[model samples]
Target: MDELEFRRQLYTNPRNRSEALLQEARRNNKNKKLYDDMQQLENKLEQALNVEVPDGLAERLMLRQSFDDSRQQYRRKSRWQIAIAASIAFALGLSTSLFHWQQQAADMGQLALQHVYEEMPYTSGVDEQPSLQTINAKLARYGASFEQLPGKVVYVNHCAYAGSPALHMVMKGKMGSNINVFVVPKSTELKTVQSFSDKTLHGMVEPLANASLVVVGEMKEPIEKTLHTLTAELNQAI
Candidate 1:
């Protein structure tokens, strides 16, 4: 597995003993060390959770189990109780793993990319553009608005960003390329333009007033120009 996938797996489940993962770990000294370190941490955590039984609890339990019927029924009940406890523990562990992974996977740029493409095919550019009022209502939630859009406002709706629903817009670019705008109310820790590109899409994240705008589209589009226009209009609105 690649480093990102390997690290994610390690973070989620250090106790995992998959042969393929073991082989991947063994391929490089650094990877092996990383795996070993994670495993060591897991061991230490498990050790920390180990508890000693009370001194007289074992003898009292033995006396209770001395009777034949009680012993047999208690044995059956003990098994069932242990089984249910293990199932619950397993579920809790799985849920914790998923939540941890989701927290680690919080990158709004990637979220914007996925949302943009997922809606691209099903929704086309402005057959009948959304009214400015509709767009502003959604944008207002984030303290941003479009008094006048830079381009045709083909689609406008709300989509999730970091588990919270935010404004989503699809605008037709000057080059006829469709631009996706995701405006989420957030305070970015860094104050710089973040750009991303892939085989089929490219985009940049622009920090805004109490929010961020993610603009994405095909490579040929004048993405930078669109961004400037959008930013200017948004600044005026604020």
Candidate 2:
């Protein structure tokens, strides 16, 4: 048969005479290659025909593919949702921690203020006679000189320091400066002196009149200078 008629018969009646014709073509040199190619194509066609398609297999495959796509989309959306939830939880935790810290800070500030107020002296009756000379003499013993600043001394009292009463005084100074002086009784335990700076003001603690004296002021000169001058002058007069 001609090539076109052979190919037509091969496809039209692939079972009958096609196998016998292919075996004869394989024996010929030029038809050998064609026979092999046609055998391969025929085998592929047999495989395609023998493949038993399940009922609604195409529809089931399409449904499975759609399900896989939906599953992938859900997974991606779930990841985003989890990430968003974690972010919200983290934000809430941070806010809660910050709020707690602020509350603690406020409570600490109040406690500090309360402590300061507790240590402060209270004023009562005005009937008690004011003994300015006797007060000055006691302060002088503690290396503190009693100098009348421009304003009257509204507050004068003795505070306990290391079992001894230390003379404490508050007086108004020039340019709205409030002068505070404390004379501690002399003790070996109060030898070490320290100074601290708070904002613009500098304060010092040192041995004066046998006790630890802490003076706070904004004066340009060193605190030691003021302490030394006051102590020397007071000691000499006493």
TM-score of each: 0.57, 0.35
Query: Once all C-alphas are superposed, what RMSD does model 1 give against the true structure?
Result: 15.7
Given candidate 1, what's the lDDT at residue 223?
90
**Who wins the lDDT comparison?**
1
The TM-score measured for candidate 1 stands at 0.57
- The residue-by-residue lDDT of candidate 1 on 3-110, one tens digit each, is 544655566678888887888899899889999999889889888656443443444334344455666786676565555555566689879998865654466666
Off by over 4 Å in 2: 1-131, 140-152, 199-201, 218-229, 236-238
* Residue runs of model 1 more than 4 Å from their true location after superposition: 1-85, 187-193, 236-238
* lDDT on C-alpha atoms for all candidate structures: 0.72, 0.50
Clashes of each: 0, 5
